[model samples]
Structure formats: C-alpha cells, structure tokens
Target: DLDGDGDCEILYGSSDGKVYVMDHLGQELSGWPQSSKADLQGRYGFVVSPSVGDIDGDGALEIVCGTLAGHLYAWELDGSVISGFPQYVGRSAKSVCAVVDIDDADDAAEIIVHGGKSELWAMKGNGTALSGYPLELGGDEDEFDSWIFASSPIVLDLELDGSLQIAVGSTSGEVYVFNTDGSVVDGWPVATGDWVYSTVTPVDLDGDYEPEIVVASADGKVHAWNAAGEVVAGFPVTLDAPVYGSVAAADMTGDGANELVVASSSGAVYMINKDGNFMSGWPTSPSATTFASPIIIDVNNDGALDVVLGAQNSALQAWSRNGELILSQVHEAGDWIDGTAVASDIDKDGLVELVFGAYDGKVYVIDLDTPATDANLAWPAFRGDRVRGADAVSTDSDQDELPDAFEMAQFNGLEQSGADDFDLDGVSNANEWIAGTNAASASDFFSVQLSYLPGEPSASRRVRLTWNGVAGRCYTSWQCGQLDEGEEWELADPESGTIDCESTGEMSHEFDVSADDCFFRISVTR
Candidate 1:
C-alpha cells in the first residue's frame, strides 16, 4: 500500500501482462492497472509477485516485479514506472525477490531477484547491478539438469554475526547460503533429493542463539542445517507428500525448544520436535491441500504458540500448539489460497484477524476471535495439573472412579471408592468415610439407635448417636420431630460425649429424645 492507512492495497502481477494496484475493496487505484504489454505484448507474461519496499527512501514504498521476458521493473504507487527500470537480467525472474540490505551499507535496500535457471542477481534501488553482479546459485547453465531458483531468498544472520546472509533454494534440490558479496558459505549448497519451492526459514531451533536454516523440499522432506552447513541431527524428516510451503519454528510445546512446522501438498501440517520426532496429535490435515507457509502466534493469548495457515480448499485454519484444530473458516468459493495468512490485531481488537491472497485474484481478511481451548483440553489432565502426566492415560491400569496414577498419591491405594468395605464395617468403602467410621474395623461404625433404659432408676427414652471423631473434624447431630412433612433437621444438643482411643479409634455422643417420634442424622465437617 502507498501508506499505512489501516487498509492495505493489493499489488499483484498477472499472467495477462498487467500490474494492477487495488485496495482491499478490490477497486483499482486512480491511474493504476498498469501493464508491460508495450515491452513484450504477446511474447511473455508475469509469473512472480511484486515486491514492495521504500527503494528511494521516499517514505512511500515502490512495487517491483519481474516479467516472463526476464525484465524487472519498479513502479511508483501511481503506476508510474520508475525510470531506468525494466532491466533485462535473464530469461525470466519468476521467484519472489526479497528486498533487503544485502550489502549492509544501510543506504537503501537491494533487491535479490531469482534469475530462473540463470543466476541469482542483486540489484541496487535504481536498477543497477551490485558489484558482484549475479552468482551461479543453482544448476550449471547449458546442462541437461540445470536448476532454477524457484524459491524466494531469505535474509538472516546464520552465524549470529552482525552481518546477515542470504539463504535460497533451487529446483535442483540444492540449498545455498551466500555471504553479502555473493560468495558461497564454507559448506553451503547442500543438496536434497528433490526440488525446493518453499522459502527457507532461519530459526534457532535449539535456542542456541545461532539461527539454523530450515527448508521444505519437494521430495516430501524437511531439512535443517546449522551455521556450518551440517545437517542437524534427526533432520530431513519425511512427510506424506511434497512440501511446497515454507517451514516455521516456534516453541509449540512450551518447552522452550522450538518445533519445526511445515505444510505439504497433501494438506497435512506437521509439528516436529527438535529431536525430529512427530509431536503427539500432529500431522493434522486441515484441508485437502495446504501450500502456504504456516504462521505461528498465541492466537488465544495462550502461553503456548498456535498455528494459522491457509489451505488450497479456500479455507483458513488455526490450530493449538498441541496440533488440535481450534478454528477454521472458508474464505472463498473456488479460489484457493496461495500466500501465508498474516495474523495480527488489525482492528486494535484483542483477537487477531487473518489476511491473505488467493488464486482467484482476491485478498481476504478473516476474523479469528474464537476463544482458545485450554491447551490441556487438547490432550488430557492426568491428576488436574496440565503440564505433567502426558502418559497418564495409558498408565491408568485401573479404569475405576480414580485413575491408578493418583491412587498412590491420595491414599496407599487402600481408600478405594468401590462398594467393597475393607474394614469389615457395615458401612461400605464409600459410605464409611462420610459416616465417621473406620473402614478397617467393624466396631468403629457410626450408629444411631433408640433405647428404653427401664432397668435404670431414672429410665427415659433416649436417642443415641455414636461415631469416631477425627481430631480436626466436627460432627453435628441433627434431629427432626417427624420426617413426614419433610421438615428441616435441627442441630441436637447431646446430653453427653466421650472419646476412647485406647480400645479402638472410637468416639461417641448421646442425646435424649424429647419427642415421641424423631429422626436423627449426623453431618461431618472439617
């Protein structure tokens, strides 16, 4: 867009030889819908997207794109082609060029254009070639297996040095990391077995502060390389289908260790750990195909990062860090998405919205306000704590009221809640505790009885309540005049109470019945 006006314009190039500048509403700019028809009318077309940057430091970004005729052009916001542009570099420059400060001069950003089977070129803002000119980053020319630089160039600091390096992939399955002078790194140009159409991502997968290169090759594998160009341990993990989307890294498991996330042509999204193992509940298939790189964010404000990506099925989906699908929305009817769906709080709202471009010549802005599921809910809680007990499910040998995992924790696996009474007391195992009785002893049971002590000199009908009292527990005896009216039970004042721990763990209380008919109950509280 010409300015950050809260709405962005689409700077798109088409095979019809046109460069249209349209807003989010799909309306063309005043003098836009420009074209390269005059230069190569029926000869070539545009296959690469226009790269935007402030080439002249004019505060306004300019649009740059390469035509199928190998001509690169930069245009102003008003569709005026920047003079001295449309420079012919090679046969074609189809891959998206990265606008970066490759020379580190800080004067202006240089354009890294892919020369499609020719060479990788670095051009100044005014269309002049850099000092090193173009470098042979792909296959050799005039060869049967000459490779094409079909992937975009990524600029990052590989060695954590002050200077940045350029990482790009070729159709010949070679991954090259080049210094700013267009020179290859020490052990670079690593070769995979297949083509690489996805952009390379440099991330600190092991939290070493030094970035590692991660690339998704068309041979259905994801490879990671350290700064020295050595394959990272357990890398090049195989997937089901060819992966065309760029790889992303984040602490998906909240382990402080980053996981490599990549999508494939078969619509599968994989979250591989640093040790190259598939995370539990991963390789999720959100759509039939996912070609765009996945974007990682804490969409639900979750401490763990989540994933957001576009699918070829015209839908945008978001997944939890544990690989559970959280939310999804179909954005287009028939147009499949081709670009990464950017996530941000576009409306200043807490929830982020997803924005992306599609194959139907339209851009989409989808709202993603769905509340994030508790990360543990995506898996399971072993004993109530979310972080641990990941394997509690299988370790639960007894499928009863309480899992065997926490059995040893609460009790010695003796306080079972089943029907069997362990103390030989009349109260069952479940009822013994509530009745203030010892499940290990028959004499320590809670009892309420009515007795007529006619043999005593002062005979009176008495209601007796007896129960074993714990030191910190208070037991209240309640009585109702009649149970027919569903009357409330009132606390009963005991005539006497006694504790005898010598013979058994026993305590007792007695209450004289004042009414002819009475119901009694005991309530325990700690």
Candidate 2:
C-alpha cells in the first residue's frame, strides 16, 4: 500500500537483522528479502515497525524507520535507499516517527521523530534538520522516560488554517502545541497529574468544524482539551485503572454523537458518551492488558464501530459496540503482543485488514472476516495526515507499467500483472512489449520464413526471408552448415540489413548460401 502499486505490503523489521516487505497474502516482494540490514551496512538492528509516506512527492511512497544504532532511514518501495537518508541522530531509546508537511517549502515532507532524548526533531526529506529543531521539552534526562517511549507527535490543523500544526504530549504531564515554525501556541502546555504516555487524539465533539484534543494520561483519566488549552466541560473522565493506551472516538451506537472509547492497564474497556458519562452494559473485560491503541471499526458491519486490539494475553480480539466478543485470534501458545495496531484496506480488495507487530519478532496482518465498504481513517493518530483526517491515497489505481486505459486494451481487461501470460504463450505480458506483438493472441509471435532459390552452377544460392516486422526490433538471420558439423552460425545478409520497421507488414531479406546443407535461423532482438 505504501508504494500505491495497487497492493498493500506488510512492512516490518525482524530479528534476522532485516526489513521485510510482504504482500497481503504474506508473500515477500522481490528485492526485499533483507532490505534494511543490507542498506545499513550491518551497523544497527531495527526493532520498530516502519511508517510510509511519499516524501519526495514522486507519486511513490517511501518507508521510514529508525535503527537501534540511533539512525533513521528512508527506503523506496523497491528496497533502494532514499538519497540523504540513514541520518545519524544519536542514541535513542525508541525512535518512533511520522512524516508531516510542516511547511510546503520543498517537494517532499519532513520526518518528525520523538527521540529518546525527550526532544522532538524535524528534518527535511533529505535528512537535514529544519532551522529551529530538536525542540526540548524540559524532561529529566532519563533513559526510560515513558513519554519518550509512548508519546508520539500528532499532526493536525488546530486553527483550521490551510497549513498544519503539531500537538505533542510529554512525560512532564503537559501537552504542548506548536505552529509549523516551532513557535509555541498561546495558552501553553496544559498539565495533568501524572505522565502523559498516550498520544493526543483530536475529536470535534461539538461539530464546530474545529477539533478538540482528547488525550489519555497515566493518571487513570481521559481528558479533553480545546485548542485554547482549556479542559472540556465534562472535565477529566475517570477510568478504573491507569489509562496507558490512547482513546478512539466513534459513534458506536449510530447516535450521530460520537463516544469516547478507552482501554486500561487492568484489562478493561470503557465507552464514555460525549458528555463524559459511561455507557450502559458497561466495561467489557477481555482479561488482557494493552498499551497498544484501540481501533474503532465496524467489525460486524452493523453501522456501529467495533473495538479491535492485541493484548498481553497473546490474543487479538474484536468486540461489538454492545460489548459482545466477535472475533478472537491467538498467536503461538503464549507469545505476547508488542506494538500498536492499525486497520486499513491494504489489499485494495475492498476489504480491511488488521495489522500489528508482535513480541515474537513478526508483523501480522489479520484480514477481517467482513468486507470493508469504504476506506477507514482508522490510522487517525500517529501516522495520519497533518491536515486531512486520513492519509492521501495513491492516485495510480493500476500499478502496471502500462497506463490504465492502455493496459485495459492491451490485456483486454484490468488488474493485470507482468507475471501473467494471457495469450498462453511462452512470453509473459511484459515480455510481449519487446516484439510489439498482440499480448491477447498467441498466434502473433515474431517469426521469419526462409526460402531458397538455386541459380546456375556458377551462380551463388539465393535465400529469401520474410517476416511480419515489428517497430524498434532488430531482425537478424544466421546461417550454418551441417547441423552436427560444429559449424558456427554466421550473420546472413538481409536485403534491408537491420530494419527499424515503422509498421506491421511483411519484411523480406535475401542471403546467398555458400555451404552445403546450410541452415538458417531468423531472430529478433530489441
């Protein structure tokens, strides 16, 4: 999906010291068996999942990730290194990142990282930092700050301007907002009682076209704050336990008004109405703790968003709005889950799939049993758009080298791959372009017919050759004597020598045969 090649690829780093890109069916793409480690020159290992963005605006997406060696890298879909990447950003505890168009000053976007140093750094797509970056948030220089590990920058247009704004929460229990130029917003960092590990999730509860920031803190409460740094009327909504995972907003009951969904470290799920009151049939217990953010999608296709997440109990579960368990999938006997989960239509098959990483060193994609009728903004927090609610979809609907209309006529249909041989000919659809033959018909191969005319005893033999010539293809005829005589084939003379045929028509060539039992073979080379 990152490449917009009309297919979704599962991208992740593994213990094998490599970055793996697999197709929707778990098949690895070519040129990607060990893309990352090899590109890094074996300098560091990758532990976190990679993010995707078309940083160069080249109509193709690039995958970005950080290494344990304190460096960040951007890779092309074909597994090639992006120029000026693998930037050495110093030591980092967890370098989770997102791409944003902080300012439309370049052809690409900036790579924003919440480094282990308890600071946020913004770099141009080419690996150079902006003028005033590495913004410090005044946190003690602790190696394991929960905020550094959990708090990621969210890009949104808080002022409803055409440009983007950045919102980040810190270990100091304060949420900070900044203009794209790195200047602080008016009412300053809003404070909470404890650490703010949850990334900010913006929801416009009052339908004002302006979104209110909803953030969960380790203080066992979910708080909503306006852009002006004032808490919403309902104040901080209390949870049964410490709220580590971020909350998701969706109208679960189809009531037009959205509900706040939060999960705690104590293995419980709570749904709070817009007014900050708990919903009926209350907290569903799945018996597993999760730090991974909860995703809201209609798992039952009942027009209400369902809850989906992986848990410490080694299971990925989905629950209905009414707190009924709909799907439960398990990993190996007792392995735990490691990262956050994202849901999207990755396969382009019109169905959504759930994606997440695991402690056992693997990335998983679980195709939901239900078909997705539309694209989901389920990835609305970390890597979502800087202004738009969701990431932009690649405009290239057909990934074939041939444009959509041309491929449709050439292959006589859609969704064609280079690997398919539609004409049942030995040549694949891609290879057919070499001879400019009809890919839909097996009878139209590049072939040559040879004919010989013997003259008087003193005269040389005349060999006439004819073929349906193709444009841009070079035709050659070779002659050899005695099939088993070890006679080497020599280039035969064509009437037109080498032709760059301008159209599809009969072409003729003549060569004089000198040796007995001479055989000729005609070949075309592009």
Worst 10 residues of 1 by lDDT: 382-391
Give all TM-scores, in the order shown: 0.64, 0.67
Best by lDDT: 2
lDDT of 1 by residue, 1-526 (tens): 3656665555667767887777656678877887774343344567556777667766667788887767888887778888779888676676776766567566466888777655788888788888886888655332332332267776665653345677788876799888889888899989998877777766667653346778889889999888889999999899999987778765566555667888888888999988788999898964677667777766555555677777777776768877787754435535777666655444544454556777776666666663322331221110111111011111122323332222322233423654666666566654554443555567766665444434333433565565555553456777777887768876666443223233334566666655443677776542
User: Which TM-score value belongs to model 2?
Assistant: 0.67
lDDT of 1: 0.64
Question: Residue-wise lDDT of candidate 2 within 394-495, one digit each (tens)?
Answer: 111233433222233454334576567788888777666556677778997666677876677644588788888865467778877767767787777746
- Model 2's number of clashes is 2
Error of 2 at 384 (Å): 6.5
Scored by lDDT, model 2 comes in at: 0.66
Error of 1 at 276 (Å): 0.9
Tell me how many clashing residue pairs each candidate has: 2, 2
